[model samples]
Target: MRYSLAIMAIALGIGGAQAQVSPPLQVQEIGSFHVGGRVVALGDMPKREIIPSPGAPPIQMDPNGEFQVEQMYAQYIKLAEPRARYPLLLWHGGGLTGVTWETTPDGRPGWQIYFLRQGHDVYVSDAMERGRSGWARFPEIFASEPVFRSIGEGWDLFRVGPQSGWNPKAAQRRAFADTRFPLAAWDAFARQSVPRWTTTDSQIQAAYNEYVQKVCPCVIIVHSQGGNFAFNAALAAPDKVRAVIAIEPSGTPSAGTDASPLRGVPHLVVWGDHFADSPFWQKIRNNVERWAGAIRDMGGTADIMDLPADGLRGNSHMMMMDTNSDEVAGRIQAWMARRGLMR
Candidate 1:
């Protein structure tokens, strides 16, 4: 289905967010696609009744479970521009949906439009079991209950502010004074949260694999947990992946995995600030550096970008949502151009 620039902006908007930006857009085509998931026999639900008044007649709702299995949910937005060398596929991190690439909480345009206006055919997706994708029953289809994230954890884990003196009033109390993330949009950011499950990781991986196959020979831009997945995806099918750009990925493949798989595809890993305050991230950063070294040793192209060291500071895990997001995108675009990946 093709969507006009204005229509897409409206569809993705919440109450106050600005419309998507698509200027100088030479988009020849814009559409969506889905991959993964299987059909299943849906079970029936218990009946329920509603009464308008006490001791009055009641109305009942006995919904029938639609029979037949369905595919796993992973939605994709495809925007094609003749200027791009190849397609650009985006993958989101854990606990988030495709909205990660959508408008920022501050009502600003997202990377999706940023790249589109830059002349690349971009595909943004809702990973398996994410938004618009269907969910299964617990224990029956899903092996475990879905896990959730709290705003407090986000404030700390995302490095939006100091861990101490954190509360629902985080926006007013202690947001990093210099953080690019719009403090006023704290509530909007929280709305992007999604249920995450450890037990379904394999399924998620499979779904991602299917997605990669469907959109191969493309550059991948992934963030947080998506970082590792993008690497593995390239490793799993190097021919399908032209390059990979990981933004603060949460994990990586074991050292035992062959780095040669990705030797042909260029790799770029980027990190934001706040590692000094988060030990967990410090370890991850160290490991990523080491991994990059190992890949380089194997005659692979593995580059690193420490945003803070690069003179861009006060960024959080959600750096793309930071105030300097377009600047960052420009940096990546420059790199891609140097590599002859895009116009």
Candidate 2:
């Protein structure tokens, strides 16, 4: 999946004069892989394939709307010392591509590079919809005479037309009717999409399983939304996962909802104090503590760290890129090293 970091700056009107202009939105592409477009067959695996190396030339997404490839940008500088264990799978946060794992602007190594240098194989992927992922073909799919007519019929009924409010429950009925055709069309297209993106949790598990079969007993390092996905994936196949490091994961579903599929996996929950102040970061600490407690209660290890107040210069959520990134990475590397996950 290709994760993207979207930065939006809103300018609010002030008094009668021109509104103050905020900083421009700066989007940084994180994930390094893109799989969406044409369909290619990789025998039973479909069109998915791991790129030969991190430096491999970029590949285009297939026309079928999807493609899958893996990149290993950093390599272990030294051989693993005897008794070293599992490799690590590094997953970036939402709106970020895999590049988040690379070195920072100041040349200080990122987590992935640090781990790789310590003798661990590190992998990164781009989620669907961003980066080199295929484009949506809505116009073409809905362009046919019959399709256009069907869409028009629904549109007419929703608006003031001859068949306007054909049903007394027009508001609700129109919404369902109008959405049905497009939803179906997209569903059809998605089915035909190649190097398909994993829409369901099962697909994610399958992908993880495939990778694990080749690199058994791997540790998962997931940031933000990736943390949620990794937790569920680990629960689905605990044997393949050695441990998980979650950096500010999203909360589990509401009450009466299905519990997280974590299944007592060992996890390290890291959060920044900024989450306590920011509205968006609201509930982050609560959520992290909730999961941490659950993991510990289930006989798994769970640790929570608050980035020092001074360490958080800007948004706490951005500590991963802060001036103290190397320090943060060092702490993480020390943890992994203690676990025998790195040389």
Tens-digit lDDT track of model 2 for 1-343: 1111111223232333233232222222222332222342332223534555699965643345433332112222223342237767776654445555665433444666556555565665543332233223323321222111232232222121223423433243332221212222222222221232233333333444454455557788777756666766676667788778877676443323233444445677666543323444565557667767766666667766565453533323434544455566667777777765654
Q: lDDT of each structure?
A: 0.78, 0.48
TM-score for each candidate, following the candidate numbering: 0.84, 0.54
The all-Cα superposition gives candidate 2 an RMSD in Å to the true structure of 16.3
Reference-based lDDT, residue 121, model 2? 57
Model 1 per-residue lDDT tens digits across residues 33-76: 66777755554667888786999899885544553222444434
Runs in model 1 lying further than 4 Å from the true structure = 1-24, 41-80, 170-172
Worst 10 residues of 1 by lDDT: 67-76
Model 2 gets an lDDT of: 0.48
Candidate 1's error at 180, in angstroms?
1.8
